[model samples]
Target: MDKSPDAYWKATLRLIGTVLVIWFAVSYLAGIVFAPALNSIHLGGYPLGFWFAQQGSIYVFVALIFWYAKKMDDIDREFDVHED
Candidate 1:
């Protein structure tokens, strides 16, 4: 059975929202609010915030986008939805 355009969009938005929330929370918690505690463990040439701000968070963001895309694709397949 074919799915409606609205269903595909809804699934995409839901994936975006879920991934964004997790990304924001992890980045904020590790980079700022818990920086001091996290600093106790060293990473490369920088402290926790420096590492997160400069490198770690960026890597995570990329992975998050890829993960979201894969997850959303699975969701679409489950619902018989497609962008085209």
Candidate 2:
């Protein structure tokens, strides 16, 4: 099946939006809104909430970057838009 450029761009944007939402939730909700409750749990030497704010979010963001790249590559292949 063939996909139009518009469809491909929309799919790409949807993937990006989903990734951003996950990033926002981890960086903001867990780090701020739910911090006190999460603080009860420990990770390594820090409270879980603090860890998310300081380190966990960064790790997740980096992982997401790789994940996004891989997904986009797959999407490009599916759309027959991938570079050789």
Candidate 3:
């Protein structure tokens, strides 16, 4: 069965919202709000908080890019809206 355009777009928007929330949490909450607590732990000689504030968020963002693509593909297939 195929979904209507409204349903497909609703799913797409939900996915985008989910991704954005995760992005914001990792970038802001972990990096800024919880930095002091995270700083207690160290990774590769750098404080974990510092790492998250600088590099971790970047890495997570890149991972999110691929994750979002894969998720979008799954959503497309589920809705029978896929290109192929």
What's the count of clashing pairs in each model shown? 0, 0, 0
Q: Candidates 1 and 3: which is better by TM-score? A: 3
lDDT of 1 by residue, 1-84 (tens): 436787777777888889978888668987778777877777885787668866798899998978987898798777866475
> For residues 1-84, could you state the per-residue lDDT of candidate 2 as single tens digits?
549998899889999999989998999999898999999999997899999989999999999999999999999998999998
Q: Any runs in candidate 3 off by more than 4 Å, and if so which?
A: none
Candidate lDDT scores, in order, read 0.79, 0.93, 0.93
> In model 3, which residue pairs have backbone atoms overlapping below 3 Å?
none
lDDT per residue as tens, model 3, 3-84: 8998899999999999999999999998999999999999999999899999999999999999999999999899877896
Order by lDDT, highest first: 3, 2, 1
TM-score of 1: 0.72
Better of 1 and 2 by TM-score: 2
Q: What is the C-alpha RMSD of each candidate to the true structure, in Å?
A: 3.2, 1.2, 1.4
After superposing candidate 1 on the true structure, give the runs of residues whose Cα lies further than 4 Å from its correct spot.
Answer: 1-14
lDDT of 1 at 45: 58
